[model samples]
Target chain A: MVDEHADPTVGELSEGAILRSILDRLGASNALVGPGDDAAVIAAADGRVVATVDTLVHGPDFRLAWTSAYDLGYKAAAVNLADVAAMGATPTALLVALAMPDSTRLSFVTGIADGLRAACRELAPGCRVEGGDLTVSDTLTVAVTALGALAGRTPVLRSGARPGDVVAVAGELGRAARGLRVLFERFTDAAHLPVPVDESVLAPAERDDLAAQLRPAPPVALGPVACDEGATAMMDVSDGLLLDASRMAAASGVCIALETAALGDDPRSALTGGEDHALLATFPHDRPLPAGFRRIGRVRAQGPDPVLVDGARYEGRAGWDPYRDWDARTG
Target chain B: MVDEHADPTVGELSEGAILRSILDRLGASNALVGPGDDAAVIAAADGRVVATVDTLVHGPDFRLAWTSAYDLGYKAAAVNLADVAAMGATPTALLVALAMPDSTRLSFVTGIADGLRAACRELAPGCRVEGGDLTVSDTLTVAVTALGALAGRTPVLRSGARPGDVVAVAGELGRAARGLRVLFERFTDAAHLPVPVDESVLAPAERDDLAAQLRPAPPVALGPVACDEGATAMMDVSDGLLLDASRMAAASGVCIALETAALGDDPRSALTGGEDHALLATFPHDRPLPAGFRRIGRVRAQGPDPVLVDGARYEGRAGWDPYRDWDARTG
Candidate 1:
């Protein structure tokens, strides 16, 4: 069904041709039987497979004008890997389902493959794309399902937190959210859309922030380390710190007390900012925090609220709610 | 952010409310760790998982005018389960990622969950919905990734066919395509769109045929039976017999010869129709065909063409091509 004579730029090419290109880029090293068969087979060495899925829609989750296809692919892979890592498992393989408009560029599709492969190579060495389905749609969307091997270790759950546990975090806290703000300010009213920006023209910090927003380098390795070191409870922070922390506290039936002093300067940014894809976990109070992790708070007996900001209630808007209508300025 | 008192009928409820409702319906029977966690874990009894993913888009895959969310969900599960069965594996679990417009009715969301659970209960007793994600989008899309257990049996592959193997099929054909024709004709010009039609109003044959198109009942058990009976190669005939047979022939470096008389009445529909999702397989010439299977052809040495009907080349439009564009009549 692949159209060999069709133009790639206008997406007159068939789904088969694009699928083959993506599969060729992936090679499926970890897949026992890769794409082209009825179904792909993968070994679940420990007798179980940890699975998670996330979807990124064009309008709400990303903007084509603000980010390239390569960066979008990188972020998609990072999001799924972070979830698997939060499960205390070794990432194994991914199945991607992509939906796009008929006019989508072939280069954009291949660029997504490149970014997904490179992220898997750098973050999870053995991970690869196993199988996927490509279809036509009005808006471009990417949905990824990631599988992981537990290696016979116990999966850390959010219900395991105790009153005396110490709350900690790995990776940056507010960089990605801050980066989004910068990009929104800079490109809010641009006449020529989706133009390439020269990084040399922007401040060093601004450029770095934009990179963080576009392609988040999640702390995939730190999750297993936290589990091995005996993390009592764990989760990845995609929503703001306070919002996610409240979730943990509610699930575990404990109160999370944040220490503003322990968090970096500008506590509001660290407390309410999100999309960093960082790991937040709790451990026994006496256990020494591992490298790449910093103590941020403590667990306490159930209080009036699930979370306390430096011994007082925080009265501010929390973080991203996917169902809310899209707002250009706030998004 | 789940809202407690928002009206579901008016689309004022939050993402959390709809998600919880769906999870409640799923109940997660096969999940070691189900939804509400970072990820879900499912047992791979034979140390491996047979995985496949497929996406259903709004305009291209289905029209909301002709089918309900329940039928959509049931078809989604059937499509993935058939692929796993084609691999000679037992269906185990599914991870669903759904993207829909914010104005989508809450009943539509929960109805999909009910349909998924019902299909799993009936077709695959032990299989269940493990985890899923729900996000906002302009169009409603469902992507399902199914996992299966091999149960220590070798997977049946399309590449295993050889000269002298007898090709056979174990399920009905042409009915789904015929059913699609009936539906398209009946609902083509309806003014009040997307209204539910009472099956009692239609002729029994038409109702039954429409059911086949909306929800296919694949020969799930026959796949494993064929494998045990030493079938050389197998695949689900999703994209018409001729098209899929050509694929198997090309993969195995052989020619598939078919006898039109062997196919049931209306050979054209049986040979060129798609979406029936019946199992097509080849067994060694000496082995006895399974109880439900009927011999339709033989594998032969490679000829000028991959597939031949009654000793002559047959030509026609093969099957579905997702990127071909949205044509309601053709679909």
Candidate 2:
């Protein structure tokens, strides 16, 4: 058991002292260059390195009352690893930077690390928490950078879509969006709910959707598979399908015609709801669709602007804009 | 020329809108992958990646009275790039995460970018600012991650020192310490001043000493050269030389004997002053010394602890401890 007195406030310990204590606890295995160095160097077997970063701020991005430090760690790592996966890379290491009030509990920090390790094991095996910096601040904020390897395959970029290319997606969509809706809109309803409650109370779909939003399971290997199978333009569906599709179209200088009617049940939810983390890629029409992916659209000779529902323009608000007052809209 | 308007507060523009405007002004070279994507991809050649991250908060790290947003950006970039250089790597890219009050002026944000670009050019030419996230918070904070390449040379580690190794250092020391002293202390007497001033007012040595502290010149090339010349153990002088030397001793399980008499004038300052960003390395006595480096000490087998002049343990405070009472000691 750990000593209770060891949990000194961050302000009470020097940066070097705190780092020494943490390093002592984390025995050597995954670490190549541990803390106290300028930058931790981890092993990158394949020639190419994959990387991504994310920052979470208090209140705007997350509320301390609603989420624990552990959840924050898990979510931050998850999001960045998902990005590496989107690039057809396998995560190998992470660098974390955290700022919080001096009075924060050591237990809270340990819990955060636990969550980070758990997510690392689930999403990218062999990934390790290599290094990080901790500082005292007025509010809690976390920034994470994840690095990975491309495993000798060409990277999947978002500017390769051409006319006569088919668009497809891997992994489930709309669940995370539904989860956010349930959590924010129906908080009171979920407050009194017990674990494994009656499915009818929340509806099976709604419960699944809420769970998905809270903890998204990104298709970590689909990106590499898509690239190997000759994906042209590729991206992750993060800010809703329509907005992302438009980005691919703009980058590739071509038109994308998404078949909304063929999207199958809850198409609108998948179209504009965000946080799906599904791989969306375009392939030449002559190439067969890879296993486990569904064809949903096609590239067109028409210029630039993306079209949906049989060549009609999508005039609705495409997705959530954090800086704007959000109001639901549909085309 | 850019448009000059009464700067709109960040609150006035949506996050997407702010990003779009910034991207428009920066043009294409600023990005490999810009904002609005899952994660920004950057070009990392030489088959190895070097990364470092740091976070700066409003109160603990800086005060708005002493630092402008532009200075904040420059300082933040400087610190991270220093880490990359310390690793014997050439910095290539950066990702910034900023959190500020909604009322921050757009002009301030642009100024911050200009500072970042300016510093990048000085430290690592062609270093691109690839991607980042911006959000609203109560107090301002900036987190930056810098990436670099090792150019195929082995990284200098801190565990290779042997009894016969010669300790050498590149670049000046104690300048930042004196600068901090001048900033915090108001001593009027010429002799009592931490930094030297005009020759008519003070000794020549003091003026040069204080100047070193204000603007540190890290010897970036020294790291790679040391590694190439087979440096036994190496590290950047972040903490005072004594404290860092003790660390190298502990890591290598050997004692270090320093000839303070050999260190160019003001040996005490060289021993305890910090933020030099100088590369300190150990090499076999027979090996040719690298240019721009001076021999300062030697690795020894006799002492139990890191020893200074006359084979005595260094008792004077040699480094900054964030948790310690700086006022009580220095005052």
Candidate 3:
């Protein structure tokens, strides 16, 4: 059993001490090099590796009141894993760096770890929490870096889309935005019993959409399968389908014409909402999509600024812009 | 040329706008999947890749007054690359995430990019900045993730150290600690013009040390050489030697004994001072030392912890502990 000392907040322990204790508990077998070194090393069996990083600050990305520590950990891991999956890679390991107030609870820290472990089990089975650094700060912030493997297949790139390629999407969209909206409304209605939205009123579509936002199930396996099946261009719809599609078009020197009518009801949500974590790709027009995907749009030979819906420009708010509407609404 | 507008701080720009502007300027050819997508994809020629990440926070890690925006960028890249080097990999790509106050200068942002480019040129040539995110916060923080290639060699890990392995180190020591000392001293001595120590001494060492702390010179090429020469256990020295060595011992399930005399003129600096960005490793005692390395210790079959100076326990401070001391002093 480990020795028990007076439990102090993160502020009470020095950075080195905190890291050392955590490393000791994590054990050294899994780590090639644990914390306290310049860096930690992990076994990346296949030579190639996929890497992604994301940072979440207090107030902006998450609220301690709204989400549990476990949720924060799970979300952080999900975001990074989504990046690796977007590259058609299988996540293998993770490194976390956290900064929080000294007064924060140890249970909170453990909850974060539990969340990370839970996400790793579900999304990135091969990945492990190899190491991390903990330091005391005024606010709580978490930064996670995830490493993945390409498994010898060529990584699907966004610039591979050619004119006339069929654009398809895998996974649900618009759920997370709806979830945020619901949560916000709840907070605003704190003066009286919060008017709970009817669960049935949230259509199956809406439920799926909310699920997509809260815990985005990144299409980790589809990337390599798409590459193997001859996908020309591929990307994950993170900012919004329209915005990401435009980026692919700009990169490939082609135009992407997304068809809103093809979006199977709730096209507005598909076009403007973000945080779906769906895999979007362009393939040869003649080929059928692999399982678990649906046709959404097509690559065009000629268009201006990557149009949507009958080659018309999408001028309305089509995705999230954190500095603008999201911030205004949240604040 | 792009359209000009009033330069706004990162907080003023939406996440999408910042990403779009950077992606547009990065050019089409180099970008596989530009920002706006769930993840940016880059083509990896070799089947192998290397990855590393580091996070830097304001006040605890660096003060804006002493370190510039450029310095933060350089430092962030340097530390992550050092990790890649420790893994016996050659850095090829980088992803960055920046969090800063709304009032941060555009010039400072550009300066940070310039610093990143400068460090990349020095350590990993031909590497491109692939992707990142920008957000507003009360303090400035930078997180950098770097990817590298192994060139067909197995990565060197720290768990391979064995009982009879010779311990060796490559790179300078104590420079960063001394630099910290100089920084604090300069602040203290600002009132007394032309005081005790030579101003020239104060500036040169201070500059060198600050550079060491800010823009570390990581030995990227050395890890592969050590791996090729049969390094049993390997790691980069980020913390003080004693602490790091202790970690190595704990990881390898073996004790390490240092030869105080062999550590060259400043043994204390080698033992307790850190941020030297040096590579430390253990090899079979019979093997000849490689170029640019000095044998400093040996792995022992039995010992209570990492020992120094001929079986004598090091009762002095082990290494840098953030919570214990903020003022410059030997850990």
Candidate 4:
């Protein structure tokens, strides 16, 4: 449906013509100098820039039969923007490098551009695609580097947690993981081949959860707000709550204590689900938590373990790891 | 041989452990906030940053049989740094995202880090591998995002050329293309495999030329010098002299006239050989060309064609394009 135009394969089109189409769809940008030049010039403002990068590979990251090109592009943009937001900066510009097999359809590439534009408009307005390279490969891959301006504010790092600080989150959890589970079940039931799943048979909440898994909509706007509210430490929960909490604890030399009741009683799901891309932060106990942030835990003095549940250590596989000898064919 | 300490494939190593090894080898950095954080913070001096990104795929870009992991990493860094330099900015920091198959060796990853560090030391001191992401993929791919600081100078765009400007280049041409030719011949003679070629059979210059193809030592030092001398326009000679020149002309709305004699007698090689990564610039006709720069041509008023040879139109292939269907297996 996205390829209503004369959909020619990339090999049939000149690279110059492909670039022209992509630039045309990118619309306008707020960068000082956007995509047509050798390199893009972006306002660094405050003499510093916050930068992060993420890569999505074809088979390992996404299955072509499972997700549309638009979803892949949107997910790529969301992941990188979430990283910049985690650094407590205003996301501004991005550089994208795409590698695809020559046999790939031109429509797929254009769909990706549209998805990037859509994400920019929905989350970080004024952020533009700065510059990038297109090259031929055996598989499809997209890598994005996001840049942000801090506006002279001190960056909220993962190493600033202290005793008595309140642990909070600004977005949802468990939905993406649950959605991934459903997708795996459906795909596996269809004999390892992609078949259309009847979404109408699923409940409305399940549909929303599946959408979250397929295309995460992170709360990027809350990053700077948390920074303004004097957040002590912050990070994005890409690897799930418990693993990220442990990382924060190790960095700050503290222990994090989580309350199961505050996390909706589904402690395991809330703590171990990955890919939610929610902002996790710790604030001083006296400071009021920002709006939309739910207080779920407390930072404590260094203990035997990094994370605790109701003052007791809870040991479990923290989150989904891409390199832990997982089933290659299914993942 | 590269991994004498503990030889293990990437499948045997965890992502966290691999990251630790990489960060350990990376040593020191110039970033304000370095690799341990969610995102790196770089000083964007003069309130702006010049950014560019490039991707290198395994089969289409380089054959593993012909080049080492070290050379692959070095070339990737060189290509991106050249883009930043082409903008007339001092290259500062880089973000690398590598996706490799599970069968890849741990030593290959470390070797790439060494190559990246070596390039930073040789070309742009004070530049650092600020941060990176390592993920599993079906193929070996390296994507890099390079950032540079303008340091209070205006960027020299490819669109700034004027009619009365002198065209010049600060680096060699034909060598990379010629080297590529030799490599392909040797590779073909070896029965489409990566049998090591006997370098002693060739002349010393030929050996050096081939080395240039494998590991290009681009003249990054001349970029800022050209800017300081008031260059009207500038770009990198990546895709070849004639093709890139035509691009510059098209962008600036001028005609570039090349003197065939100024280049070597084999005008075709000098004109159409790509991947030289040389600094090409245009200066006012009355101004002295920068030191080490050789005058090769002149900018002319807008004409019927974007580029000309000795004031005449020469029709031929501009340069090596990756997308063109050449030798499917060898390329």
Candidate 5:
């Protein structure tokens, strides 16, 4: 359906020319000193900036056959933007550092730029790709640094959770993890290599899960709302609800008790699955939960365990760790 | 002199353990929310933050055989710091995203952390490693994002150069490139593969060049000084004077005239070589130049060429572009 030979590899073009192609797709810059300059100057009107960096490597993070260039870019931006939002801040700009093989197509590069723009426009409206770096590497890597503004609010830290706080969550929980299962089961070959996904063969919910895994729409806007409504603590449930909640509990010196009945149909996946950028926040028991957040748990005094699900310590595996989990493979 | 076997590989350790090791070496937190949080909150006292990103890929950016882990970290931080300084801002923090092979040693990771700390202390005081991300990749890559404060001054842009402006520079011109030549000439085998650098065999000047290439110390503090002293235009000369100046010339819609006589010792290398990281800035003709800055040339109206070396267009290779230069040899 497409002419592969028509697309030029990045190595065949000058760096300036490739840069021009990427810049063309990124739209207008809102920063004071945008893309062309050595650095971008972003307004931090509240005198404080929230910053975070995250990287997506080819083999461990995603497979080229399964992930389009656009999804890669969108996921990279979305992940880092969620980190900033978890700090109760609004993302203003992203600085992406991209390194790829010389054999990478120029069209693929532009596709990434378009996806970055789309993610910024949808997930965090005012955010834009203000700056970036490019280099040649054997492995494809996208390292994105997101910057945010707290807008005169005290950052809601994970250590702020008190014993009487009510735990709540916003955004999808188990969808991304379920999507990972679908990929491994349906789209992987007998040799354990990923193949191109066939969406027509999958049901609607499966398709939703797959989309959630590839192109997540985290509740970035709700982060600020939780802050405005007096959230006691907050964090992004990235490495699974159990693992991240345990981290928050350990930091707060409290015990977290989750109600399994509150979680959707797939409770185990919701508890153990990763790559879900759900905002987990704690609010005062007396106050009503924020508009987008739904109560899922409660914070108790520090006990033997950091997290207790349905009044019992969860005995299953907690979450994914790249060092312990990823098996190096390329398709 | 070092016990390579004593240091455990990162793959054998948990991701949390590796992160703890890196965090241990990064020193105290100057940020509102430092490492260990979902994100770091940094102070932007002047209401604006100057941000920049630069990456060093293993093969094209450096040879692992020639560069130590310490040097790699230092160079990565130094390059990004120079970008922020070129914008006439004081660097405040750095967010590093490091991706490496699974077999990389834990000591090597700590070595990089030490190098990053050392560079921040020596080159840009008050700046610290506020946040970072670590991932596994086939290629070793360091992507650093530096953030700075302008302190209410207008950011100096490359497009502000006008006719009759005095051109000046602050740091080394061709030392880093000369270092690369030294490594290629003396430290490579007949197969063009790099070997470990033997500092004992090199002369003082050669060693200085090597150090300049590996651990550059750009005049970061002078950026704000140049701004305070009324610099009209400025940029970092990372890709050699001719090419970067040509870029400035194009951006400013003027011609940059350089005096080869102003270049010390090796004028040709100074003219064509790259990776200098010197601050190339312009000031009004009336006032005396800043303390660290030395006059080199003057700006002229738009001409046939963007850059004129000694009043004539240079005919040799101007600089290195990874797209056209790299040969994809890992060794």
Candidate 6:
């Protein structure tokens, strides 16, 4: 039962009251026109803006039992920021659309707002929530749209990779999936009451894995650097490396060859793991590799298989396909 | 009860397959980079972009039984378009984030996509769905983010109204709310099986009201016209004229005095009905009202009441507050 002295539920508060709480946490606006207007006016200095949207829905994306409000907000912002960065742009602003059950606590809402600000400050500095919409729903959902400025740099597309390009990646790979495994192994017990995760007992490495799962910090700063370094093709590694690489290969009408030896201890996990938000990019073999990126593979002419591991076709699970995997569950 | 051949559920298909079906219906993209990229690159002429987001959740916003997928999509896009237009900008692109239950039919998904495209074609030409994300959820949600181009014009703000300014409005003021009433009176019944509305027997005016509720076509084009005509302050009338006008009044530190005689047949409904998305604007007293707008009231120095009707303070409900009104229900 809710304590009478405790903070009231969002159902008991006005939308304006909740909005004021969030705005207070978001700090100041850097756009031409910020919140409180019909719409926000943002400066697109180069006359062009890069935009992308991503949504995190309850159950399918995360379980409240395993995630905190702050982590949820952080993950939501980080995921969308990764998308904008994948386009070789620096995020200028974020528009968040939050829908939750009215029973959600006012403190929980503020926690999320604080998390949104914290993510922007830590991951994509200078990029903050510019405007958003809040509504009540049966299921909790966070939909974020990120806008970025290319600053006159030509966008790096997945279809731009050519033969003889060196394949590389920036940011961690497989760690998030490992974190997911830890959650499934240690935290997904039916016996435990629903509560925020306690990672104190886990080993240091396992704690790191959990952090990767809950709050991913992708290499956002390296996106523009990769573009400036003449990267030919790039994309966010959301679904496994094997699956996403094949997409880039298919888009470019080329083939990507991976070196399992380079994949830190668990090659299989690195190849098939998902949700790392790593930047997968292809650069010219002649130029020096960018500072944050590590060479892991190479680009070749079109082949029967879009991706090959150490010369042979890598088989088994290609990666996470939301529809297919989700179907497997409910079926 | 399930038809073997009626359409496969979204759970039975891959995300890519569902995406392909929707993409087939969404025509083409006019942006620099469109769907298929991590992010879309849209041209924001004159170095400024207008951005906004709005969400329609299943229960609070629309019911599948009462609203067709097409109408839901159209209304979703239209509402966001009005927000952008209220800033005196021409919408250039939309990014839609849709989350639905796994049991949702492919046909329904495609219908919503068709509706989204139809709204763009009819309401704001040259604007299209450039990118979006689709996911699974227990509750259906549609979140749309619209981007617009200012074209070197200064945006009309709600805080710019002066005491001598004349208040004017473009488009229907209370039609959508009337349609909502019709829905509650006839549609929200315990016996109704959720079905697309059949308004075959309604009178023509009632039909128009229903259309306004289901698929609102707000005066989007008039926003730029008002801007060019030197509207001192402006906003969209989503939450009724009284509430929205008071918002404009409070932001400008003025009092809005509305005349009932100017509000057509049902002045009460016109004053308090919501969801019309009408453009409420103020212009200098010396300038002639724009062609599409009708004079509604005048602005005055700040008074005890932010809004005055016929020189007296409004006594009844000021307007719809999602929080307060919603609490009255669940309580």
* Predictions' DockQ, in order: 0.72, 0.42, 0.31, 0.79, 0.89, 0.86
Better of 4 and 5 by lDDT: 5
lDDT, candidate 6, equals: 0.91
**Span of ten consecutive residues with least summed lDDT in model 3 chain B:** B190-199
The worst-scoring run of ten residues by lDDT in candidate 4 chain B lies at B187-196
Which regions of candidate 5 fall more than 4 Å away from where they truly are? Answer: A1-6, A329-331, B1-6, B329-331
Superposition TM-score, candidate 5 onto the true structure: 0.98
Q: Which 10 consecutive positions of candidate 6 chain A have the poorest summed lDDT?
A: A188-197
Query: What TM-score does model 3 achieve against the real structure?
Result: 0.84
| Higher-DockQ candidate of 2 and 3 | 2
Ranking, lDDT, top scorer first? 5, 6, 4, 1, 2, 3
Tens digits of lDDT, candidate 1, A1-331: 5354443743577767788777777754678888889999998988999999999998778888787889989998999999999888889899899999877877788889888998898888899988888888876899999999888888888888999999999987888887877776676655423444456767988887788788988899888888999999999888889888998999899999989998786677778887878898999999899888899999999989999988888998777677754532443
TM-score of each model, paired residue for residue: 0.94, 0.84, 0.84, 0.97, 0.98, 0.97
**Pick by DockQ: which candidate is best?**
5
How many clashing pairs per prediction, in order?
Answer: 0, 7, 6, 0, 0, 0
Q: What is the lDDT for B91 in model 3?
A: 73
What is the C-alpha lDDT profile of model 1 across B258-287, one tens digit per residue?
999899787888898888889999999998
Cα deviation of A221 in candidate 2 (Å)?
1.6
Q: Which candidate ranks first by TM-score, i.e. highest?
A: 5
Report the C-alpha lDDT of model 4 over A1-331, residue by residue, as the tens digit: 6463578878777778889888888988688878877899999979999999999888767777667888888888999999999989989998889898888898899999988878888989988787788888887899999999999889989999999999999888888888877777765454675555568877898788778877889999899999999999999998889988999999999999988888874678789988889999999999899997999999999989999988888877888676774456765
Which one wins on lDDT?
A: 5
iRMSD value for model 5: 0.7
**3 versus 4: better TM-score goes to:** 4
Error of 2 at B182 (Å): 3.0
Report model 2's TM-score to 2 decimal places.
Answer: 0.84
Writing each residue's lDDT as its tens digit, candidate 6 over A1-331 gives: 7574577788888888999989999999989999999999999999999999999998878888898899999999999899889889999999999999888898888889988899999989989999999998889999999999999999889999999999999998999999988887787556533345678879999999889989999989889999999999999999989999999999999999999988889888899999989999999999999999999999999999999999999869989987777642521
Query: Model 1, B122: alpha-carbon shift in Å?
Result: 1.4
